[model samples]
Target: MKTRIKKMSDDLLWIFYPTLCAACDRPLLMGEECLCTFCKYYLPRTHFHLQSINPVAKHFWGKVPIQAATSYYYFSKGEKVQRLIHKLKYKDRKDVGMYIGQLMGSDMKDSPFPKPDIVVPVPLHEKKLKLRGYNQSDFIAEGFAKSMNAVFEPQMVYRNKETETQTRKHRFDRYMNMDNVFSINKELAASDKNILLIDDVITTGSTLISCAEALLEIPGTKLSIASIACA
Candidate 1:
């Protein structure tokens, strides 16, 4: 009886303030979420987890030692992926990350991708985190951890320095901007355990490279990387 009432209430509220799809801006039907079914179906999944030497892994070649790397989707400008990401990062829709993470986790269930003992999201600086009121990546990592049955350790890595946005920076300049920016918590470090680093997106991968370098400092730690999308 209570569930019926809640559903009715939601339907009434939706009628007055319709929830639009993040990608297409269409009013979402009942039971649809941040994205409609059509957008979700065609979101450009990379399926990189199925390949060992995929492009994401190759990007880290000679730069950092990662067991493997994959991204759930291919991101492009003015596309559905970008719109979904913009909603998550700039529009306070953290659930978008969780939704995407759960989908990514499900897709990796039978793949050859290495499972990690711990899942950690790339941290945002204190100032940026304060302004944002949340780390969007945390929801992604949290949902992924739940689906993967791994430990979610958001504090395992810390961002000590506030760096400028890499949106307009060149590759080398982005690498320099992210240098010495991340540090790991010694107490949380698990020696000889696999750690999966999560990020929302990978462009030049400079940020992930810096985070991976810090995570590798832990003795006997095997590191891997995953992201919501690759640009």
Candidate 2:
């Protein structure tokens, strides 16, 4: 009887304040976190975490020496993963990022990669952060930190200036734009720990490479990279 009452209370709250799926923009069913059931099953999973030479890792081949790199899902044009990312990035659906991060963290717990000493989210420019009211990647890192029982440093690296979107830029242009864009904070640098860098997505990987380069400048620091999705 108590469980039924709690269910009815939840239903009434939903009726008054419906929560929609980040991917499909439809009302989420009871117990659903972010995506609807169909969308969740249909999301393009990358399975890159199980592979050593996947596209995600290849993106940094010879550019940076990362211990490991992987993404949770594959991103394609007009796909559910793309839609989910768009909502998390532009529609203020930070819960989506956190949910995905938690799932990824669970998988990593069983993988061979050593648990990182610290987790750092790729930083957004202050102007963009102010406009968005939150850094989606930081929320993602928070989920990973909780599940992995590791320290989360949301401000380990910072964007020194606003950068143009890399979506339309060539590979070289993207690298040029991201070069030296991140600066490591001295407090974070002094730890000299193995770090897991977190981000929402990995496309050209310019951003992660840039952040990794900054961290590598610090003595005795090692880096790995993870993201919610990859393109």
Candidate 3:
């Protein structure tokens, strides 16, 4: 009875506020669609998935030796992609992250990149996780795992220290501060696995590089990366 009541309540809420696209705020029709048709076709894709040395990979050229890297879309400031990401991170729209992840996963399904054995999302500090009630990267990983037919290991990595936000920090400062912020959970390590590290966005690639650095500590682990957007 409780489950049924909860389902009915959710149904009523959806009726009161219809499902809308994250990109354009238009009502979405039934069947697995997230973005409106206009937004779907018009949104700028990075096409990095099809290239070996794309801009996303170039960001980490000298910093880390990632096996592969790609971003689903190019992020232009003050555009729909930026707005969608803001809502996903700040406004608690986790669905937006998952929706974008699913879209990217579908695109990557046919790409030339090698398949990954597991997906690992960049972890949030315990305090931040408690405050937000969820990790946005975990949601993105869940969507990617479903579409890519790979395992999603939410606890494979963890943030050991809480660092300041990297919003206004210079690139070098970000790299320095983020270096020791992440550590791998030794209990969850799987030997010789190809791990696909996931995050919401890639700016200087500092955060992802930090996480990858920790993951690399584990012997025989290969690392790749994916993100919703690249700035």
Candidate 4:
């Protein structure tokens, strides 16, 4: 009886405030959440998790030691993926991140992707966190951790300083800008643990690298990386 009542209430709510798909902005069906069925079908998956040495993994070669690295989707400018990410970051649509991260987590289950002991999201500086009201990556990591059965430690890393956005910076400049920006929480740090670091996107990988470096400071910590998209 309660289920039937809730359904009727939801239907009435939809009539007044329809929940549109995050990707296509289409009215979502009863079973649909965040993305429409067509948009979810068309998301560009990298399938990099199946390969040992994908482009994402190659990006970190000779730079940092990683157990594995993969991105769930290929990100392109001015496309559905970008729009979805924009909604997650700027539009206060955190469900989009969680939805995408859950999809990624489903892919990783019993797959080539290494199981992680802990899952951590890239942190935002206090100023940005306050301004944004939430860290976008936390939602992503939360969904991922749920599916992977890993500990979600959103505060595992702290951003020490605020830096300018990396969107317009050159590759080298991006690296310099992220240098020494992250530090690990010693209380949460543990040795001989496999850690999965999560982020929304991977462009030049400078941000992930800096976060990985801080987490790697703890002894016997093996790091892996995953993101919603890779540009």
- The TM-score leader among the candidates is 4
TM-score of each: 0.95, 0.91, 0.90, 0.96
Would you list the C-alpha lDDT of every candidate in the order shown?
Answer: 0.92, 0.87, 0.87, 0.91
Tell me the alpha-carbon RMSD of every candidate: 1.4, 2.1, 3.3, 1.2
Model 2: residues with Cα > 4 Å off, grouped in runs? 1-7, 15-17
Decoy 4 TM-score against native: 0.96
Ranking by lDDT: 1, 4, 2, 3
Expressed as tens digits, the lDDT of each residue in 141-161 for candidate 2 is: 988887898888998789998
Off by over 4 Å in 1: none
Summing lDDT over every window of 10 consecutive residues in candidate 3, give the lowest-scoring window: 27-36
TM-score of 1: 0.95
lDDT of 4 by residue, 1-231 (tens): 999999999899998898998887889988888989998888888999999889999989988899999998899999889999999999999898888888888888979789999989999999999999999999999999988888999988999999999999999999999999999888878899999999999989999999999999999999999999999
Q: Which stretches of candidate 4 lie over 4 Å from their true place?
A: none
